[model samples]
Target: MAEASLLAASIAVLVGTVAILVNRVRTPAWVRDAQLTLNASAVTSLLLLVCGALLVALVLAFGIFLLATRHGVVGRAMVCLAATGIAHLGVTVRRH
Candidate 1:
């Protein structure tokens, strides 16, 4: 179970990293941001946050699709749910 959890997390991180690279790590308006600061560190942090959120959302949606198609494991579905929940908490805290 631990290994499965780690594998899921590792894949998520890899996907997020690839997304960041593909976007050239630019702070784009693909996601709405109310924060007006455009400093270098802020831009990088926002990029990371956006990519992480997208990754979490994708994983959660994929799990739901799988279940709907009768191709999902309950454990993996639970893992995806927990991942999104944890990610939401982290993003909420960091954004504030």
Candidate 2:
């Protein structure tokens, strides 16, 4: 599930990045406005991608931790949630 989420997120971010790059070369005001929209979309997609990647990283880390000593579901869950929140916050900050 985590891998699937990460894949989807990365694809979305990649698409958004491409769209932004395409829009950036335009010349008109209306076209520039449209590019701004693309920028917002790219930023949002990037945030989701970052969060998903972090979650995958956390899952791997927890898997290792489980092999070491005690199993901890709470810590892993916290890591995932924190990664998501931080990604969202980063997007919000970047937007403003």
Estimate, for each residue in 1-96, the C-alpha lDDT of model 1 and write its tens digit.
865565577568645745554454244552235233423376676776677677777767776776687654643644455464555546444444
Candidate 2's C-alpha runs over 4 A off are: 1-40, 70-96
The true-versus-predicted C-alpha distance at residue 74 of model 2, in Å, is: 13
- lDDT, candidate 2, equals 0.53
Q: Note the residue pairs that clash in candidate 1.
A: none
CA-only RMSD, every prediction: 10.2, 10.0
Candidate 2, pairs of clashing residues: none
User: In order, what lDDT does every prediction score?
Assistant: 0.56, 0.53
TM-score of 1: 0.45
What value does the lDDT take at residue 29 in candidate 2?
A: 74
- Where is model 2 poorest over a 10-residue stretch in terms of lDDT? 70-79
User: C-alpha displacement of 54 in model 1, angstroms?
Assistant: 0.5
